[model samples]
Target: MSQEMGVGLLRRHRDFRLLWCGETAGKFGASVTAVAMPLIAVSTLHASTLEVGVLSASAWLPWLVIGLPVGAWVDRMRRRPVMLAAAAVSFLLFLVIPVAARTGHLNVGLLVVIALLTGTAAVFFQTAYSAYLPSILAPEDQPEGNAKLHGSASAAQIAGLGSAGLIGQVAGAVNAMFANAATFLFSLLCLASIRDREPRRERTTAHSKALLSEVGEGLRLVAGDPWLRTLTLFGAASNLALMGYQSIQVVFLVHTVDLAPGAVGGLIAAASTGGVVGALTTRRIAGRIGTARAMLLFELGLAIFALLIPATSAGAGLLLFATGGFCVSAGVVAGNVIKASFQQRYCPPELLGRLTASAAFLNYGTIPLGALLGGWLGTVFDLRTAMWITTAGVPVAALILVFSPIGRSRDLPTAPRPRNDPGYVHPHSEPSPRSH
Candidate 1:
């Protein structure tokens, strides 16, 4: 295990620190929007339960729509420019929301448009950012870098959630979006300050491969590799359930639990403190129990508490929601910490963008569907019953991870199986980078 150097990276690595600050700012902004956007739809636009689901779905729909091509594009070009352009687009989209709202022009349809456009930007930024990280840091420092990044993101989420409510209550949800817009500018400034440049992409004769063929190569890499396949499948299932509940959680807290709009943010912020706890403890727990086993403990074992969410009522009962949400956040973030380290070590650098996009396509593609499902269920049955159905699937989804090879081993495989083996090439072998 690496020594807990604490401030070593922050103090010594200039470029990493810039990237960390940028990412932290971006996440904080996004978390605030996560709460404020829903509040706008519910409170300002008078969006129905179903419309809110559609709004949530729209934000993630781009993953399904543009994911494959974006991955291939990220692999072929410089990542930083892609990230810069994406951040700029997100900044403009968010800036327009409050402007439109103040002008008496905001509506559910417009909100969906903003969500879709911003999400499209996210597709580019997230894919490029994932691929860009390794370029900024040496292989040995990546685990430490990832821990700090994830821990800071979790902390930012907590702060953002806490502040979103107070800001929404005092300033109104429309103006609160100004804060999200500001964070993007902060991110852009930080990104611009980074000193390290990516090595020029290596060129090769393999450039002749069709773009679709390149996309197919990435898909096959994940499909043919057992470790990647299991994790991808588990991610898809887990996200489906996670998004389902998330899409309607605001409705449950406000309408079902009868909480004030301002109180919603604070309670959620309190629950998200668990993400910070999870990120901090993941390395230690993995060191104690091994990474693969720790994954099960995090995903399958602790995730079971998600059922307690629907059981929440008022006053004392809200504690049930808080506790359940806290456990779920902790488990999910801890598992993510383990997974990020595993993927970075196991996969080839060139394929990281496509691997991230392909996996996210499976993982995040379901978000829209889950949002729609949760909304539909909430309308047909009731918010509380919908909550029950959706939250229950969270633990049940973990069974996918448990039954796969992840459950049988103490650690996930760090290398591909032998070439002649079933889980090995054609696609498992790393491909040379080519100018498209």
Candidate 2:
């Protein structure tokens, strides 16, 4: 598709517009919760650094616990209903938080439970949503769709993060959760309004497979493919390092850097602007420098800025954190836009749900471990020392991409090599498709 065609998709496509709005709204709410949850634990309950880390871990733990099966299940059912249920569940769960705080019933344990349950809902919604997108847009339109959705998500996050601290300061941290709940409601309404319907999937008895068998197929698909394997590994390693530092960032800024709540929100919102830029420019960058080269530039080249995060201090030094964060955010978001488009085109539509879940299982599974590691490091040593260790791992993790076939390629492959092609090299000699 032409650039002009992609840019005009939102205007021409009504169902896609609804999907974009709902997804963007959902992202906005999640971003608000990201700031507000940690703030509540720190400011309202006086949570320790380790407690904050555990809280962060709780939110991602469900990915490890149920990711595979959920993917398999989602493929068997229509995606929209699953997303609707998940959104409803998330809305109610977020709604309960402020109520509990007001009723004097809020506690760390309750918070943990809420986080875990909401995370479960997120798993279903995300899995269903990933699969559902391909059904809405034609193959050529997917890149622009992914770019617009990711860009809008980043923009919504900026708005959410910018507002979170003001809400916290004015209405109290616990009550700020009301904003999150409201966003989910908006998302639900938008989703319910979509006019297009997904045709029901029909499975013959001979084609049916057990859940575990389906899960294994998904796992093997990712593991056996060179491109998917390489990208998945890079994502896993990168997230480990990313979440490790992020899990403790609030504590590092609040306690070590001595920033107030509102200042903290403003700084993070400033840093997140990079995501918006990255999303807006990714398609042009890939067009200019091949998609594979763009991935290397974004994932390996820009990630070097992570080292500056540890250099953050009180006043003038805070720019160090923002600059580093901006680069990392830009790189990660741009790379994701490329990757999302690649996957939509490359993978078989039948297995997209499984593919998403299987990849995410490995990618997000490391998050809890990273969070705990950050917490343990903070507890065992000091917060700054922990930050130094974790932030340093960011660029190092990209070395996986460097040693793999991605480093040598100009563009990622458009389709998987035929299974019967005996001449295929596991990580080399793959066919390159026309550049996006």
Candidate 3:
């Protein structure tokens, strides 16, 4: 293991090491599937843009629909089981693709169903992960741990996607899916290896209460807190902007930039490269600038660079969009590290899972809309005009945070909010809890 890694930083803790290794493998496998599934829809199934949109939406739409309820359920049970089961099911789901493709029965409807199932498994994995880490690490180390997870996942997306793209080209799409299936099997093995007794907090199927009330409670904390509220709102706004751009990316690259599909996919892979760099280096850079300033300024720069995309000539659009992607990726990585760290700090471990889920529901709920908007808007207008709309929406994020605390400060301890308290602790300041 790398000594400087977050898990390495906790090298003496055997259980955490096991969990870390498992999550790393799981994240990598998940990324591979995320990339491969889309290719299968486009190539083997001959799906149209509307069909592809449904396939894509199927992946994230569950997060909006069932994320909170699932979070509540996971919080009520042992998370390790949830994690292990998710890995197993994901493996089975991917395996179905190759089987269906071979049988000559693969269709858009079936692909959509598969995407939704895979997405459901992903929700479990993520919900367990969000709650699991805070319990394992001390408050101070949460940021480093989160930074590592984000960094590793971003690298995995680029690496895994790049590899899958190559496989799709070299072999057929059906054969490429085997890679994802293989990854899931490895992830399942890793997850099964974690032997630590799950540590539980105040457990509840909190959703059984009035769904509206539970939602309100989670929303209230975020809305009531100056910092948390700002981060949540900004995050939602950011997702709307970014997802909007991503949804239309293929069209923009194809229609406006005049690139072929393969070239467009490769450009996106290149753009995510910057995000990987940012994730790997978040801790060092944030430590030097303070988390607050780093997040605030980087996001502003991200918006500016996003605006520069539509202005490039068609001949150079690929390069310009690639450069813009670099900035957006960097900003998202850095911003997410700061924001998630801040959230994990002030949130109660008991509320962490459900709260995270509820917040995810709001932020990601807009994503489906963004994708729909991008596809429809791109189809209707000049692709360049759609890009302009996506880029311009970035300011809405800043606007949401303008009156909140995130724009002003950076790091905070990942402890739950004190009962009606007024201050926060930085995780690095009091990390002895993790050494327990």
Candidate 4:
């Protein structure tokens, strides 16, 4: 990596800079709403825990339905406009919430619909952003770029959680949603400032595949890949455990731990600090430890952290929660970097968008199930007992990766070379002024 590229990434990489700023704002605001939304449903709308679970599922449900077709569509176009449109629509939707609430027209049904729309729009934005990232930097610089993205994401998670907690406490939940909406508006403005050119593809005249068939093709792509198949399974299992825990987390914090509502934000921030630290160090760690060892190390750490959750089942205070959060975040950051680097190499460029969406959809599809299970269990069993049931699955999920080649492989790409996949632009092809 060039010294100049490193220097420029701090604030240069104009497109990354703008995208980062906008996304960071969006992420932070979303974190606030993550807490506020459920809190509002429970407190103001008098929704049941199961209803909250359904709402949580509503947010992720779109991925299961529209994930693949959207990927195919996204692949055929420049991503920036798609990203901009998604953000704009989401911003508009969020602004409507405050107006409705103040007018006494806000209802539980409306909030669910809003959550669903926001999540659905987020799918397009996220997939496009992921696809666009690789073409932005040098091939050798990818690990560095990915690490920085993760770091920004972690930092945003922390800021969002903290801000949400503070706002939720001071302004009340309804007004707090408005504050998050304002952040989205600001994010749109930041996106507009980023001027990096997207890949120019001539509009294709090929007939589009049927929606379900496109979804099937995406699934077939993953199934064809040995590594991706394993990774997909691991991701699916991990979401099951994580979502299960998330389902009851709010109630646990409110009822069992006796911590104020703001404490969840503190816990999220506490764990996200580990993610920030891990993301900052990932490139160096990959260089030093090699990719395969890093994967195993992160997974083991994840399992240990998962196992330690039951220790907190006895109420080890906030320290236990923080420890769990830290390890979880660290493991996730390390694991994702490895997965992303591998995917960029393995998945064909023409199919990258769909394959990624397929994987995400399959993985996330389990979330609603887990959420429903958690809510029912938490409602029936005590908090500690419900937690035990949930935590048991974490080690199992982490260990599932042990059976995959990804956990045992260490190769990391240091160059962007063309293969059968010709749809991608090799950013390394053009000499950057910052090239070493």
What ranking of all candidate models by TM-score puts the best one first?
2, 1, 4, 3
> Which pairs of residues collide in model 1?
none
TM-score-better candidate, 1 vs 3: 1
Worst 10 residues of 2 by lDDT: 422-431
Model 2 Cα RMSD, Å? 2.4
Off by over 4 Å in 3: 1-7, 200-215, 254-262, 310-316, 410-416, 420-436
What does candidate 2 score on TM?
A: 0.95
Give the lDDT of residue 396 in candidate 3: 59
For candidate 4, write residues 286-394 as lDDT tens digits: 6666665566677666657764554453245567777887887788887787778767765656667787788988887788778877788877888768777886787
**lDDT ranking of the models:** 2, 1, 4, 3
lDDT of each: 0.86, 0.88, 0.70, 0.73
**Per-residue alpha-carbon lDDT of candidate 3 for residues 1-436, written as tens digits (9 for 90 to 100):** 2335554665766666667666666666665555566667666666655555566677788888888787677667677788888888988888888898778888878877888888888888888878887777777777777777778777776776566656666776567667777777887786677667775544345436665566566667666666666676787788878777776565555556666445555666787787777887667777766666567666775657887666655666567877888888888887887777877777876677777887787777777777667666666777778778887887657666545554444444445678555344344432232221
Q: Give the per-residue lDDT digits (tens) of candidate 2, residues 207-259.
A: 48998999998898888877889899999999999999999988888899998
Write down the TM-score for model 4: 0.89
Top candidate when judged by lDDT against the true structure: 2
Lowest lDDT sum, 10 consecutive residues, model 3, at 427-436
Question: What are the models' TM-scores?
Answer: 0.95, 0.95, 0.87, 0.89
Q: State residue 348's C-alpha deviation in candidate 1, in Å.
A: 1.1
Prediction-by-prediction clash tally = 0, 0, 11, 2
Model 1 quality (TM-score): 0.95
Candidate 4 residue pairs in backbone clash:
292-409, 292-410
